[model samples]
Target: MRLHPVVSLALTGLVALATGARAESWNSVTVSWTAPGDDGMTGVASAFDLRYSTSPITAASFGSATRWTSTPAPAAPGTTQSVTVTGLLPSTTYYFAIETADEVPNWSSISNVVSRTTSPMPDAVRPAPLTVAVTSVTDSSASLGWTAVGDDSLNGTVSSYDIRYSTSPITATSWSGATQVTGEPLPAAPGTPQSCTVRGLSREVTYFFAARAVDDAGNLSALSNVPSVTTLDSMPPGPITNLSVGFVWLGWHSSLAIRPRSAEARGR
Candidate 1:
């Protein structure tokens, strides 16, 4: 005997976006279901309404649950459908349910609720400390280079770089007080080389710099080994300004002498 009246709403790894998501990069959780006929699955359903939440989803609370609009159009009865819910925190569980309607706008009962939990730190790992070094320096700027590290120990590119510098050494305890560099280069693939130039530094001063990586899941990496460089001394002394001569003599002698220059001389 074969019977398919349409009643299968559940969570399957496969994903398709309803309207909003970053599925292209996230390859994460998705909801799968067979169109329900409680309202009208034997006939072509007009639309689908998918909703989800952090807690258990039920018929009584369906109205307040978050709705995922722009859901895919329903196929004939028994055809499976799915959607990828995006922008969720790591290590958290989510509940989902769906309903359908006919051309007359008669909606079906909320399907069975399904649940999924996002992965926390992928593989329970953190990125290795990045290796950064000051490559060059001038009177007012310094260039740095480092080998890029992955989000989870060289597995995936990190989401961002936390680069900072200070007159003293940079460390986890003092990271917040260090001056954060603006326009840090975006993270590259693990083992790839990356660099950035920090400008507007004071001449003849030494600066210690460090960096760390952050993953999309919000996990932070260890602080990098600190490297430092002293900027070149200020530009050569300006052209000689006061060059007049001076002489010390007894009052008895009537002799004309040049006055010693006491203050910086201006271009005359």
Candidate 2:
């Protein structure tokens, strides 16, 4: 209640910088990956992962490198570990680093060693596997067609086709409301011929069709495995009789079989 020793040491150094950013240190030490550069483009995030340096200072002098795992792993607060360091040693000059356990040791400030020089793994041009076909199905409409995309590896053309559906056979991670067919680059070799006919839909209902082919820098080919359709009842219902009711002694006691020859005409 009296005196300023330099204003109480500047309020005790602002309460030790807000308690050291809240007792920082979530510890995992090492377990991360990053190698961004795929250029497939569809949502383009190019994955990432590769760390072994910069922490509280200890462990990892440098010995192992090359780890990227994201077959279907990358979605959450978003950063569920990544690894894609394939055979790296081409031009030798590596010194990668990127640590982040979401919050531990509070690491995420050492990504400036991106000096890459490995070029000899770019012969993986896959773009030929989209031959879907349903042709027709009426009840509300649906006539999708596809058979184009014949290995356009470098010529690079295709550009559109990703129509998925699911009435519940399971295998649709969420398309929100998928139905996008736009492929028309043909001249033979399964490269030119596309069609679409999807309307209202809902009569006898029972649908499931599939298609996939996107190459113009969208790169998405591995989802043409759910072809099915059953929608045609526009007006079908005419054939069902025999109501029955006594009807001639139930149709002659079920086609007659009750005979005793009337015991000689029942004793005359």
Tell me the TM-score of model 1.
0.49
Most TM-score-accurate candidate: 1
Which residue runs does candidate 2 get wrong by more than 4 Å? Answer: 1-134, 138-143, 150-164, 168-190, 194-203, 206-208, 214-230, 234-268
Candidate 2, 17-65: lDDT as tens digits:
1122232112212223332222211122322334432322112532244
- What lDDT tens digits, residue by residue, belong to model 1 across residues 1-268? 2222334587776343322333322224688887755344456677788888888988899889988875788877777887777776666788888877776666677788888777552334668788898888999999999998988787998899988999998889999999999999888889999999999999999899998888885667899999999999968878988889999876676689898765566433
CA lDDT for candidate 2: 0.45
Determine the C-alpha RMSD for candidate 1 after optimal superposition of all C-alphas. Answer: 16.8
